[model samples]
Target: MEAIATQDRITSKAERLRILEQTLIGAGDKGVRPSEIARRLGVRRQTVYRDLRALSNAHVPLWNPGRGRWAVLQDQYVGTVRLTIHEAVALFFAARLLVRMADEFNPHAVSALEKLSLRFPEPVRTQARQAARQMEGSPRNREFVQALESLTLGWIERRKVRVLYRSAEGRAAHPYVLHPYFLEPIAPGLAAYVLGYEETYFRSIVTLKIERMTGARLLDERFEEPANFDPAAVLQNAWGIMGSPDPVTVRLRFTPDVTRRVKESHWHPSQHIEDTPDGGCILTLRVGHTLELVPWIRSWGRSCEVLEPAPLREQLGAEYRAAAALYHAG
Candidate 1:
């Protein structure tokens, strides 16, 4: 009976410690008082203090913020990760790429990079630490952070989210109740987008940029993801994050000068390249929407020409002509 009782006490203590850790983590930088922690966990102040000490001894990075408040140094706490030298080198390079890609501050990214750097040796470690510091210096976007958090919660818990979104067109903010299906990071890494089923407004699956979300709230209403809904399948033909139900085939003729540059990388899964008679190349690919391809097509300048889908060709022609007129007027 004594042994059983001892086991019970051990189990209870372990559970309490787990909950206590979560409570402290959720408290964030402001932290919680010992008295508040005791109240929340239905424990004595002495017990909370004892657990805090145990956690601190276990290297949980708990810190006192005066007024008897306790908080975890969130950024300093990274659970153990074991990596081989090759794996670590790969991660180091990926970290650098992420740092370059990030246009806005993300505390989580900074913390992750800092943690990863600790596992490395010498110069590589120093470089990784510097990369993290650089990211830390970037300006924080509170709205984007909040929206990302809310959408992340919705996606993880299969909950609906209420969002106020403003489009790129600078239109009035519109409200949406979305069932977040996926969170996707778009190219150049400057923006993130949430693909979801809009219960309000669109009444269909739509992609909304996270930066454009002014406000977001996680709803109590939960949802079951459709059995047939496959994110990869949905984005199979996507040029970027936005994909259409119907796809279109696009072909572009690249001049010899840029043909080698274009052929250096695989741009799309559906791409088919053929050498032209004039030492140029004809690149053909299927994409869900021409809209996402416009900027990419324009970036190649006079080195490329859109040969198929007359509508897109005409659109680019009109835009080019308008730009020419502006330059001519100037």
Candidate 2:
């Protein structure tokens, strides 16, 4: 009971300090009064004065300029970085998107923002708080979240992990020995992929969907992450997630209807678009394989045509034939 009471005292002291810092840091030139701090913290005004005196004695850079105003002096605030309301809001949203990926509300992140919001003045403070409450996060699988957390620990500690993963076809689960290196969050934060060294795949790196990872445990063994390991450099060779290190040159022709959309944002790092004589444009890319690119190619229907890379063209033809068979059969 004594230990519990002592812990409570420590927690209360920390909260008081946080409140004091937040109030002073955001107080600007007008400064804050003991009454305001006391009222906000539900403490007596004498307690606020005593706390301020203690803080000043501890070299906390608090100043009691003339009058009853207490302010955080500018000279003592030089070293630390301060975030503006806009930056704080942006960070809040970005963190919100990742919260779903973690499969739980991140209390630490929320608390940090809450403390930072204390530094925001007037309408901006209210706005930041409201935005934080209203922002929506993506849906994440609990099992996948657990796996990701464990794998992240292994990645940070440079330890190996055993993952029970199920393939897309819903096959039986298989245990994979992995040396986790990096996590890649897909654009718009829809999903994430984990890239690492799989013991079964020699001399090459492998990728796994975080959602497919049912279980992950850190092993006692440790491994060194390659100094030159870069996810972008490795992914640059392909259209989507996983691809070979070697880049392949691929070209395609797109009709005028969707030419602008195709040219607006780069589909691949190596993409180059050229206007054709007809009302169309030719797109070129140096990628690793056409397997992932096949589905996207088919999405364009007749608007897109594979030009270079004869194998991709043949594969597209086969896809078209199979698709046609499906429609004809029905």
lDDT against the true structure, per candidate, is 0.89, 0.75
Give the Cα-based TM-score of candidate 1 against the true structure.
Answer: 0.75
How would you encode candidate 2's per-residue C-alpha lDDT over 204-297 as one tens digit per residue? 5788887788767879999888899987778877666766867778899999999988988878878888998777899998888877778788
In model 2, which regions exceed 4 Å deviation?
Answer: 1-82, 85-140, 188-190, 200-204, 324-330
Identify the runs in model 1 with alpha carbons over 4 angstroms from their true place.
1-79
Q: Which of the numbered candidates is closest to the native, going by highest TM-score? A: 1
What tens digits encode model 1's per-residue C-alpha lDDT throughout 1-330?
999999999999988988888888888888899899899889999999899998888779998877778899886675456788888999998898888878889887888788889899878899999999999888889988888989888998899999899888967999999999999987543679998899878988888899999779999999988888999998999999767678999999999999899999999999999999999999999999888899999999989899999999999999999999999996
Q: 249, model 2: CA deviation in Å?
A: 1.7
What is the Å distance of residue 243 in model 2 from its true position?
3.0
Give the Å shift of residue 91 in candidate 2. 4.3
Top-lDDT candidate index: 1
